[model samples]
Target: PFRFSALTRSCVVIPCTFQYEEDIPLTRGIWSKKTGGIVFHNGQSNVIDHFKGRTKILGDLNEGNCSLEIDDIKPFDNGPFCFHAEKGHDKYRFNNSCVFIVMKSPEKPVMTPVPAEVDAGSTITVSCSVAHTCPSHPPVFSWSVPDLSSEISHTLTSPGIWETKSTITFMVAAGDGVRSLTCTAIFWRDKQQAGTVKLNVK
Candidate 1:
């Protein structure tokens, strides 16, 4: 995985992949800081105030997906997070397989075909997309064009980058000459970011 860039008050999924020869069917997951301190473990979780009950294993350990999910991320939760897995008689810690979190501010959504051009009585497709670090809880997308239905898809384009896109097909009618096409990315906790573009119908 890569050093993940995240937004404050958002969530992040630290992709923890490792190889082990444990034959056991179950494994215990652990998350620690780069400085060798246990932040979370399946045995017993005794973490800082900011991390208590905010972290969990989002992947199946037996399937070799030890990805960790952290919710309601704060500045105090920033770190180079590491993972460790252990089964009955086998154990291995990911010393180098760690991910760092980079806190970032919010940004507006991107609308393709800037100054969206449309045909008054023809069919057209337009899309709006945005990037976020949290895949477990993806950002919700909404469009301003009420008559057009949107199809959204999510992709993990990179190690720590997740993109949310909304594709809309419109059957242009005899509407006004120009109007606003607004798109909004709605996050958890009622946080939202919007981008609007005024377009003319030919």
Candidate 2:
């Protein structure tokens, strides 16, 4: 069955199937995310990494259902996710694949920063946000600061799926010039982390 959703930060179910003629006790299915010419491993062994805490498995493994539950969705996550499932048999094996299209809300995302450019010794504020996903729940912002080598601050407003923002403060100096600063906001609904921007300090 085909599914669609107006909500940007939401998980959509895609029904899939895999069958084998032999009596196989265990059938395995694989889920992979393709982004920027990189294939992110979604599921393997028992659980997924980074995605383990966020992703939910809706399909029945024994029944040969390979449907996936994508969480913390984002616009960047929109792509042709290839789902493959295989059933091993005595002589031959069976496999299947499918694609899903995740739609985003018109609201999209708008990032706001306290200062576009910061000085050597000061605090910097960067807000990662989305216009709207639903009325009851608002978007959250989460900041990602790799250069500072410090922890990030995340603010949540509603359902874990809505949005998250990260904020950080840094005291810059000549030594920090080689380092890079970045802020990332991940919509919990689809596990979509947006493109990172370089922090500018004066």
Candidate 3:
């Protein structure tokens, strides 16, 4: 089983691999939904209209790669899909080998600096935040600064939505003229989004 998470209106790649007992001449490949509705077909003649121009095979079939790419993903695209392969007079359906796609909204992180301008030897706090609906799979936060002291917290902003905030505290030094702090938010399935803020030391 495979799982993929992607932002709405974005593209996602569903990786697939298969092996057979004996080497046989490859014929075609097909991806279908749980209801046996064809999402994609190698011949392109029987492809469902909903996925006609939005889906494509990413890997070469001759090399036994049947990965698929879906563009402009929508909420309706979420669900389980399986792959089917065909060889000379032999057909194989991988009902067990399925992929589930989850769709989410893309939220860019926001960086806010307390005391926008800091003096040398003074401490300042920079906060990076993002709002997401998946509380069960909260986003992981990371700062670009190594060995930086930080604190993380989360709040329930609205129904099914959560706001995560990471604050980094640091004292400005003469050597730290102008520095940039980058915050990366990683969601489930390795979906990563980031934002940055530049600190001005006066």
Task: Score each candidate by Cα lDDT.
Answer: 0.76, 0.47, 0.74
Encode model 3's per-residue lDDT on 106-153: one tens digit a residue: 788999855667687777677889986554456788878643488888
Deviation in angstroms for 188 in model 1? Answer: 2.4
Please, what are the lDDT tens digits per residue for candidate 2 over residues 7-40?
A: 4455544455666434555545556553322122
RMSD of each: 2.8, 12.8, 10.0
Give lDDT: candidate 1, residue 102.
Answer: 83
The TM-score that candidate 2 achieves is 0.38
Worst 10 residues of 2 by lDDT: 34-43
Clash count (model 1, backbone only): 0
Q: Rank the candidate models, highest lDDT first.
A: 1, 3, 2
Best by lDDT: 1
Compute the lDDT of residue 121 as modeled in candidate 2. 66
Candidate 1 whole-model C-alpha lDDT, 0 to 1 = 0.76
Q: Candidate 1 clashing pairs?
A: none
